[model samples]
Target: LSLHPVSVLVLKVNEVSLGIEVRGEDLAVALQAEELSLQQLGTVGLWQFLHGQCSDISFQESSALKTDHIRPAVGLRFEAGPGAAVHSPLATQNGFLHFLLRGCDLELFTSVLNGLGPFLEDEEIPVVVPMKIELLHSRITLKDDIPPIYPTSPGPVPITLAMEHVVLKRSDDGVFHIGAPAQDRPSAEVPKSEKRQSAKEQMFLVPTEEAFGQLVKELPTLQKELRETKQALADANQEKDRLLQEIRKYNPLFE
Candidate 1:
């Protein structure tokens, strides 16, 4: 997908004695589009933020790599504020975003994102495209419940890519949730020989090029609202301080 010229949030990586830790900050990842409705953009934001961070990481063995594993094993921690969901035009509820990823291909994904930098910046990236990386033995947990890892074919069990085919929904309670993709039967589109392939074997996606554009278009409006709210809060605090000072004038302790 196309990434516009927006502020990028970077993820930080740390290699401890046990394993690798990847952490990213909140980033705007919402698309104000009519074709596909997105109630929450946390998943998308997390990917973009992490991708940006991965670019900043130093790949030297003496610096970042410490473990004996051939490929770096990664654990992802994602967090975003309620207001970060810029997709919904009228989102009043301040929801929270949290998720974790295990056994993802950090190196390959990082390389892919880095390669797409020029294209994304120029808004020339293709829409609905698939990448070469797959997350093997990876599991993602959103909020409280962890989705069950479904078995695929000969490659690996519970494989997932970035946010390609993954589906998330907002429940009746207005909470965004992630669940396992339904697999009742094989599709007609798939060949009979490949029907037994697992969910991870299939491609999944995050936000599309159109969706990214929509988000960029909506960011300015949100920023204006945020500025006005902050000004109002500052004014209120000043008024409170004035009243406190006036009260202190009548107290002997002030002398």
Candidate 2:
């Protein structure tokens, strides 16, 4: 995959504290055509929108902190690549698959920071302080395979796969759970009366009865105005056609 231009909001490194922080914004990644072997995936291409923030990266003394962990908020998306779905367990009805991630928090632990002790003698590497991360909302969509148009044309490609979104939320117990794709209770558990009331409450928004009555009263007038506008447009078109015909009679080039 080829990397596109990357832009960051802020980048800071503290030599005294032996810490580094990077806050990125509007970062993009892309894969050009024929960059990878297409024998298995067939003319694959990819574009990524990294619109999430990564903040609060610092190194601290291992003993001062409890455990070394990194959790970051993330918003990332991948687009138009069959290679992305190679490891997916789910099957797509169409030939393409789209992936979307929103509102996610990821946490992981590692000892790589502490292993850097030999590089920096004066500064102590932290073995316990967790890395903090934040990600924003993003989506990836797949388009229909249109050879010759892709990797050349600058126009937008048409999407083929249905977009599926997943949201991660931390519960009160501090464990992350899938908030979307909510489970439905058994139909037998809900009474018919309650179901009817719920349906009534879910009605779409509409004009108030008084406002609707007013509109009804002026319906004839509105219809008359619409007809007048259409007539005027027709008259203008006729006039334009007459003028063009006259020009064609005089100018052989126009004819």
Tell me the lDDT of model 1 at 208.
45
Task: Please give the distance, in angstroms, between residue 123's alpha carbon in candidate 1 and its true position after superposition.
Answer: 49
Model 1 Cα lDDT, one tens digit per residue, 132-240: 1222344332221123365553432433344333435443245554543444234654344234322331112133466558768888997999999999999999999
Give model 1's TM-score versus the native structure. 0.26
- What is the Cα-based TM-score of model 2? 0.21
Candidate 1's C-alpha runs over 4 A off are: 1-24, 27-204, 252-255
Error of 1 at 41 (Å): 39
Q: For each candidate in the order shown, give its overall lDDT on alpha carbons.
A: 0.36, 0.32
Q: What's model 1's overall lDDT?
A: 0.36
TM-score of each: 0.26, 0.21
Encode model 2's per-residue lDDT on 1-255: one tens digit a residue.
335422222212111111111224211122111111101121222233243333334432212112111111111222122322221212111111112222222121212223244446656542221111112232223333334556767655643322244434332233454433322446675445325321211111123365458768888997999899999999999999999999988995984
